[model samples]
Target: MSINRSVENMAKGGMSMEEFKAWVRENIDADEDGKITKDELADIIRRNGEWFAGWKARKWMRSADSNRNGVVDEIEIGNLAEFVQKHFGIKIIS
Candidate 1:
């Protein structure tokens, strides 16, 4: 789906936390590497029309990359929902 459409879905509270995570994996993982990188995270934030996307992405990476692997994998992805909701203003229904 287009980033705009994904953003619209999120803004409409049409996704649960699990669905949001899947959305990020599907739509935001630019490289399709099964992991979310800092750049990808920043891009998603920017797509959402947020200011300081880069900085916010960095903060989120720090908070969510539990192993400090420099990327968020499936295990770490769950940590991002709260940050996404809080920082990106994306509503997570569950």
Candidate 2:
């Protein structure tokens, strides 16, 4: 699927950033750091299959990582939520 379609699917599927953060905390944050490492993020994308391709994953990390930090924290996740809301017109209450 195209990037737009992937985003649309995420919105349509009702996967809010808060929910995603929980998922990350439960599944990706194995180190218990409250932040998702790049490797963990990439692994999640890979496990999810083609929708979260390498390029898209990198793009998302770059876009969401506002502080340019290596990991994605709560603030960056909020930014991602905003991006989804703005781009897909989905209101995610957080």
Candidate 3:
């Protein structure tokens, strides 16, 4: 199931962009993969703001480790569109 980008990112809940980024990074960077890639971003978004409990705990841990650098950093994480095109095997909307 897909998750609401805003829902998972609701931690910011009226905070500033910096705070929002931090919250998103904290949750999105679950594997500590420095940047939040498409797959990594997807999983975090997939959590659907549910806290990602259950079997997904260990399964999606390394789900977004596209770089294999052992961490998903912001600099490494590309835009959502770019990531979706490359990792999701879908046609980019340009």
Candidate 4:
């Protein structure tokens, strides 16, 4: 495996949804539902997107926590975001 991918995978071993999503973004570009295909995965990694640039880009994608239970929305987006920010320093902007 490539160095970046190896590191990303290593980080993912203990990832939550937020962290997974962030890793996905830098390492993945998933669609609205957070599902990724093999082709898309290849395309994303090939582009050389780091696991996290730590940039506070402007965006406010709907929370993956769809249930509104005040906890990950019963999804992985928040968790993934947290991980990305914490490990890679990629800031999440609203």
Give the alpha-carbon lDDT of every model: 0.77, 0.64, 0.47, 0.44
Q: Model 2 over residues 57-81: C-alpha lDDT tens digits?
A: 6766776788888778877778766
Candidate 1 lDDT over residue span 1-80, tens digit each: 12345566656745776777667767789998888899998898788787888897898899889999899988877787
Off by over 4 Å in 3: 1-13, 49-94
- Tens digits of per-residue lDDT for model 4 on 30-72? 4534453344444544555534322212111222334434323
Best of the two (2, 4) by TM-score: 2
Pairs with steric clashes in candidate 3: 32-71, 33-71, 33-72, 33-73, 34-71, 34-72, 34-73, 35-72, 35-73
Q: Considering TM-score, where higher is better, how would the candidates rank from best to worst?
A: 1, 2, 3, 4
TM accuracy, model 2: 0.62
User: Pairing residues by index, what is the TM-score of model 4?
Assistant: 0.32
| Whole-structure CA lDDT of model 4 | 0.44
Steric overlap count per candidate = 0, 0, 9, 13
Q: Please report, as a residue range, the 10-residue window in candidate 3 with the lowest summed lDDT.
A: 85-94
Every model: Cα RMSD to truth: 3.9, 4.3, 8.0, 12.1
Q: What tens-digit string does per-residue lDDT give for candidate 3 at 33-78? A: 4455445654664566555443443333355345565444564333
Winner by lDDT: 1
